[model samples]
Target chain A: MMKRSAIAFSAITATMATAGVVQATTLEDVKAKGFVQCGVSQGLPGFSNFDDKGNWTGVDVDVCRAVAAAVFGDATKVKYTPLSAKERFTALQSGEIDVLSRNTTWTQTRDTALGLNFTGVNYYDGQGFMVRKDLGVKSALELSGAAVCTNTGTTTELNLADYFRANSMDYKVVAFEKADEVVAAYDAGRCDVYTTDQSGLYAQRIKLKEPDAHMVLPEVISKEPLGPVTRHGDDEWFDIVKWTLNCMLNSEEMGVTSANVGDMAGSDNPGIKRLLGSEGDAGKNLGLDPGWCEAIVTQVGNYGESFAANLGPETPLKIERGLNALWTQGGIQYAPPIR
Target chain B: MSTNHDISTAPAKPPIWNDPVYRGIFFQVLVLGAVVLFGLYIFNNTAENLERQGIASGFGFMNTTAGFGIITHLVEYTEESSYGRAFLVGLLNTLLVSAVGVVLATLIGLLVGIARLSKNLLVSGIATVYIEVIRNIPLLLQIFFWYFAVLRSVPAPKNSIALLDTFFLNNRGLYSPAPMPQPGFMWIVIALIVAIVGIIIMRNWAHKRQERTGQPFHTFYVSLAILIGLPALAAIITGLPLAWEYPVLKGFNFQGGLVMIPEFVALLLALSIYTGAFIAEIVRAGILSVSHGQTEAASALGLRNNITLRLVVLPQALRVIIPPLTSQYLNLVKNSSLAAAIAYPELVSIFAGTVLNQTGQAVEVILITMGVYLTISLTISLFMNWYNKKMALVER
Candidate 1:
């Protein structure tokens, strides 16, 4: 925890130091540097977290690993820069990080006004409210006059205001800059309700002293399509990140798993052949090796595999793939074909 | 002397670099040119970067809707308020916290400073411990201690700790009765103003009479009576035109009162306490700067200890204290920006953090935020300079 706060403070100073340094041709820069400096959240379980041994994991981390695999054919050829929400964009804009995959929402203002390009939604999420079950608040409509705790510099605070005001309910918002501080405040009963993205709510619920005492309400207030973000002007880097997600989604749609990717490489299906770069020059088009898809699958796995590995029902967070499942699997995760 | 006569011959005129007046002007111009170039370099880089990234560069975003709610705003604000209004609200909150912290910290610091000078061991020892402990720790950690560790430990609002039936304390905040002035409150206000004018005139007359007749009057007692007694009389004649809106536990938290959130409490406590330690040392140094001869001289004239310290020692010490004391005041105000860490809705946290994030106008938002702090520092320094002048020694 001490190391984490120290990193956060340093990240702030680092962002300030590198402010307004334009990083164009980021693809060339990464290729020359031999690694992608990926900006991730300080620590959000089921998204991006650093373990005791300082290894990064989760869906967001896998996005960076996949990009590294596509670029250098090695998943380990990547570095992590943990950023707070307030520092994330500045870090990205100032060239501190090649790509920001910190579970950030893809809103219109951020996409247009913030000089950011949201490649594609890696996780389709929404604003959610969690409350202690003993409060007898079964639904969000019953949460009038409740004090809500959320992190600053995010859309959660704004969404909470819109939701409560639309429902004609009075509420107080207690915002903290750090995610853990919000969790701590909510756990300590400093607020009556905790609101954020649904995935975040599930992840932070475990931090409470009595995790079983809380229940997430059924209402989702806002559309929070979270994805990897790159600077707006760098079309090549944007294509690299966008295709990385599409490749993962397409591979999953084609029934490719990390365990069977090697065997599927020899398959006779033209679509599979084209996707794995065994028969087509799709990887060449993106300035990558021919076997870029194979490298990503063999190293990181498909989108579903990454999700089940990090946030499935068997995992601690137990987040369901309500909207993140593949198109054929009765969910909204659709990807463009490799061809 | 005749042997070294050739060495005394007039030397050749030196180069411009060796001429002190020319060198000073040349170096000053060089420095000014370098500074201007450096500033323009950054400006060009920022403009290019912003243009390349498609970030709009201007103050136009200030008029956009903030779409956020503030916990405690001095003026009216809602989600509908523009970002400009939100900036003003944040500025007011920052000034409010810093001003209150300055007053509270000065009082505590003065008391602690004087106690450290006490002959009693326990009193001085406690003051010493406080100064050492508080001054040694980082202010951010102290703020975290008060916020996450102390204030967050308070009980929930349902079981709020009541204070005098008009105040409540809970994890949410401290609730105190908000005074509501009625129609007749105007007459009381007018009466208080009249009493102040009357007292000022009386003080001037008393000073002249004392100088003429050498007969001292009880000016302090008379001034106190006029200030308080006039207000009391007006209130009674107007049937007590002030009402207290006591906080009641209506729903989730206290209502109908002035609420000070835990964020405010923790920020105020941390800033004041941490700054207070530094101030205590300053006060101690200032007091010690006064020579003991002044105190002995006063005692020789048969003045009491308190009177001698106030009339003789403090006046001299003020000269030493005012300069460094100005710096501490400025430091406290700037350090109040750390209120951003705990989500205190101060200038930096709200305007710089939320507005910057929402608008994505880093350059504009940061420039304006910096200007606010600059303005605040200048205002404080100007006020302190005037006060220092008023307290300056007038040597004959």
Candidate 2:
């Protein structure tokens, strides 16, 4: 009797398993849901953070907006899910978010082992250290035997360990799971040095009680190519999200700002015309309307515009575009041609 | 009689559905089969989904190097250690905090519970207020208050508060002298063990002598003296085979010795005080469940107040206390997981939070963590049940 029941149970499960295999495409799922679910950081200023009025704005946030514009032609059709460092990849892999636009580094292990793919680098960053002025530590070499505070589950933690071990320095680590906790611990003098990406160091310095008291050290420990991530299987959705970032980068190279994109669409330059969707079939290749790039450029602006607005000199972070400028502008930021 | 026996024995069996014994067995078997099928379906579905997602599912990740640093570890762990060693480090840290928290909470709970029943109005009132306030507030908030508000307010390492030129207190940690054993320390250890064994034999003999002669012996005082004197004599004879290493200021912080990080102090304080409140209530209930007539009976037999309470009331009250006390202990162990929030590097913080994220083997890591907690809780339950059985009343 038990054997017969087991066979019947297996049959039922087989049917259920087959039924579960028929899943809708991510883009179609997003369209049906009427919004793109974007995973962002809990709060990292100039990357992805909320204002007092609850409006999200950042370079990373603009990536999500651009993707939403490319898909739905309305930048506001994106919902945000704030995730921590440890929870971000799981949130994307478990299908809880349509796209992960958080400031996540593109590492070999994460790109290959995990069921995720990095579309492109949005911001080129490197791990650095920040110390209080009173500590009088000018160079990274002077930071021997210092206690370092950093967020857990990030490349920064491993880099800090490697740097210290390579230099034969004795140091202690006080790793927290949240960025805010690491800041709090460092601010409370629990650690002598606060380490993260250089851009993050500048961003978090403003959150300190006395921002002027701390200074970033002159050390770039590791290459941190921060980018958006998507699940590995869906090629169509991945192409759309990937090209959305490319559209912004390409627009910047062609001097197509959001303010000038409307007028520039009628230009005689074939490159600008093709990029603005006035000449080529770029949007159709990604399964979108012809005016998809136009919507993205109009609503979320080009890459330079987003950078200058969120993380430029006028912002509290005052981060100079050292390694994040365009390739023609003496930095490594480059994108392929629209054609 | 034979005709009646035939009528009773040969009454027709009801239909199998109407028969209670057969029907019960059939339903049980049916439910058991359904449960087995449901479990199999879930297991198969999860495995299939994980495979489809391109995630490697297994315990192989435990062999990889966990290239992250933990803030605190009870075992010898470094970034070069395997993920399995990291798990052990996290487990040991969790056990260390939980064990210390249980012992401290019990001590505080017992004192407060007895104080609540004291004759002095001030004592009872204070105990009542402590229980009410602590039990009413949330434990996480209490942890935050201790970590951020109290411990972090201490002076930094540059201006550490030094005590007796040996210990120092700072926001980083409490640093003190660590004992280093010399070459002849083994002799001292042997002497201490021998003294303990001798004390146990002496205690048994004293108990028997008292039973026969109706006289009491001061076994506790003698055992305490021998425990201290034997070790001290051995140390003196061996030319004092111990040295103290004091923490001193190095570059940015103290360099060597023993340091208890503020995260641990805050977590231990929060866990002990919060769980202590519930234990106080349990202890109070256990004491109150004992009848007042038992105290009166002891006093009528010429026993003093303290002796009556200890010998008569407390012995009976403990039968009620041990069962509930076991639950409070289990709660303290579970509540130690909240240490993760304050960065204590316990099992959940370092293993589940950091290791799981680094490896991206969420299913395997979570299952292992859950298995660990289940094992710890079941062991506590088994030990407590055995203790409860021993304390149960004996009947003639």
Candidate 3:
């Protein structure tokens, strides 16, 4: 009887879906709602978190605002839906949110298999372990037979295992489901080590009562390039997001700033002219007005401004621009020419 | 066979259009046809979409090397290992957490549930509070509480909290002595199995003797003696061969112990505490559903409270409890999927999240995950149902 009812319900649901009762393009619905419904992190400090007045801030959060600035010309034109790692993908796939801009790592499977389009790398991270400084452990190699704490169901878990086996270390693993619990178990002296991305380890460390006592190990075991992601099959929307990031990177490269964007829009530099929509039909080619990139730059500021505001040395996160700097400056940040 | 024929014939005599049996069959056929048609349509559309994008579909990529790095794995794997191997390792990890979580949850749950009904108000209240606090919060939140707030506070490896001389706890995980197997371990295992078989036979004999001659044997004491005595005798005969590979305070961390990571701890604790709440309610209902008169009569017969519970109340209560409790257990096993939220590398994390991304076979990956979970749920239900039937009273 239950099975029969379930089948009927499913059939009705399929019929409704097939009959176009629900539009598949949530991107349009989001625009109609006057805001991009972006899923972000609950609170990872600089990556994504709430501020003093409960306003969301962070490098990842800025990505959402940038998209909104490009789409709606208002940086604040977005509804933030804070999501954990597990719920983020499903929420995007299910159309519960428009784009996932959490501190999510961009991987092959999440990009291709989960039908997600990663806009671009926002933060480059790597899996590293943290332990108390008094442990005097210099390398992860000394972690053999250690009770290593790591979060379950993540690339970190797999990376932890691979790192250990590759180094021929025989360690015991303590797996948890949240970053907070890993810290708690560590705080209660339950586990001997904690493992996560270097950035997360830093973000989580600040919340600890005595943050100074622990130290993140120097060796980053695995690469964890975190980025923003969108659903697949919407090329127009994907391009909009991708170029939003590109525009930010290009804005910084072209010496544009939130303070100077308006004045420099009439500048003579051709690359800047094209990027700020003062010259060339670059935005037209991408199916948007010539002013789209200008709106993104003026409203959302450049990538450097966003970075410094959220995670740079000025903020509480105090993250250095190790690899996030411009390509000409020996950093990885580079965007193709607007032409 | 004759009855089936008669049943078929009984409803077939009327016109095919008005026949109830034929109508049922026709409706079923229509529903089945619609399902197939819908399924085919979706399949066709997806295929065309993929083809338009020039994305080939197949599980042929299973053997392809996965370039992604994994943090930890039980078996050997590298970036060069096949995706299939990576998936298998992931499945093992999932099973590993579920198996461990199940055992621990049951132990803690049974204790707390019974404590809630204890004569002591303090104990009952504590148990009640435990259930209430864990039950109301989302399991994910609980897991986060354990992982971040709890484990992150531990001292580093060198300043580890020593438990006994051999075990140590630090921010990492629980490190205890891992028994390095010796030659006599097999004999010990065999002796333990023999003891179990003997106990089962002894229990049957005790039951039969009680039924036939009204003679009751103390099955517990006899089983305990057999279980311990046989293992001891075997060990002694094998020269009492045993060695403890105790974890020691090595250079920076403990060495030679079976370590349980903090992440696994948070997952287990959250999973157990969360599911145990529902189990407690199930147990309470099962216990309360048994008439009070049964307990009162057992007391009237001069049976001790423990004996009364063991012999009368519990046996009946289990009949009501087992089926529902099994579902709770299954729910727990499924909820372990949340291990991904914290990166526990259960099915969703390792296979669906990791492997599918690397391989790009979304359908194959998702189907496998769904199938694995369904199989696990079915097996657990079947086992519990069998146990429930066995415990059920045979009233004449």
The 0-to-1 C-alpha lDDT of every candidate, in the order given, reads 0.90, 0.91, 0.79
Error of 1 at B188 (Å): 1.9
lDDT of 2: 0.91
Predicted candidate 3 versus true structure: per-residue lDDT over B1-396, tens digit per residue = 999988877744678899889999999999999999999988987776555433447778788876555445778876678888878778777788788878777778777878888999999999999889888898877877777754557777677888667788876667787766688779988999999999999899999999999988989898999999999999889977777777777654566667776667778878877887888878777788889999999999999988997888878999888988898889988898887766565667777876654455566788888999999899889998888888889999
lDDT string for model 2 (B1-396, tens) is 999998988969899899999989999999999999999999887888778777777899899998787766777889899999999998999999999999999999988999999999999999999999999999989998999875567998989999997999998899999999989999999999999999999999999999999799999899999999999999999999899999999998998889999999999999999989988988888889999988888888999988987888777888999988988888888888887777888899888988888899898899999999999988998998998888887887
Return the TM-score for each candidate structure: 0.93, 0.96, 0.77
Pairs with backbone N, CA or C atoms under 3 Å apart (clashes), candidate 1: none
Off by over 4 Å in 3: A1-39, A81-83, A86-131, A137-205, A211-242, A265-272, A319-323, A327-332, B1-14, B39-164, B167-175, B202-212, B217-219, B260-309, B316-318, B335-366
Ranking by lDDT: 2, 1, 3
Clashing pairs in 2: none
Tens-place lDDT per residue, model 1, A29-104, is 9999999999999998889999778799999999999999999999999999999899999999888999999999
Best by TM-score: 2
* Cα lDDT of model 3 by residue, A1-339, tens digit: 999999999999899876663354555776779899999976788888888897998888889998888877788899999875555766776578888998777877677756788889888888898888877788878887666766644677668768877887766565554566567656666555888888888888888778999988889988788888888767778888888999999888888998998899789989888887878888787766788888987887889999898778887668888888889998887887788
Q: Report the candidate with higher TM-score, 2 versus 3.
A: 2
Q: Chain A vs. true chain A, TM-score per candidate?
A: 0.92, 0.94, 0.91
How does model 1 fare in lDDT?
0.90
Residues forming the 10-long window of minimal summed lDDT in candidate 3 chain B: B48-57
Q: Is candidate 2 or candidate 3 better by lDDT?
A: 2
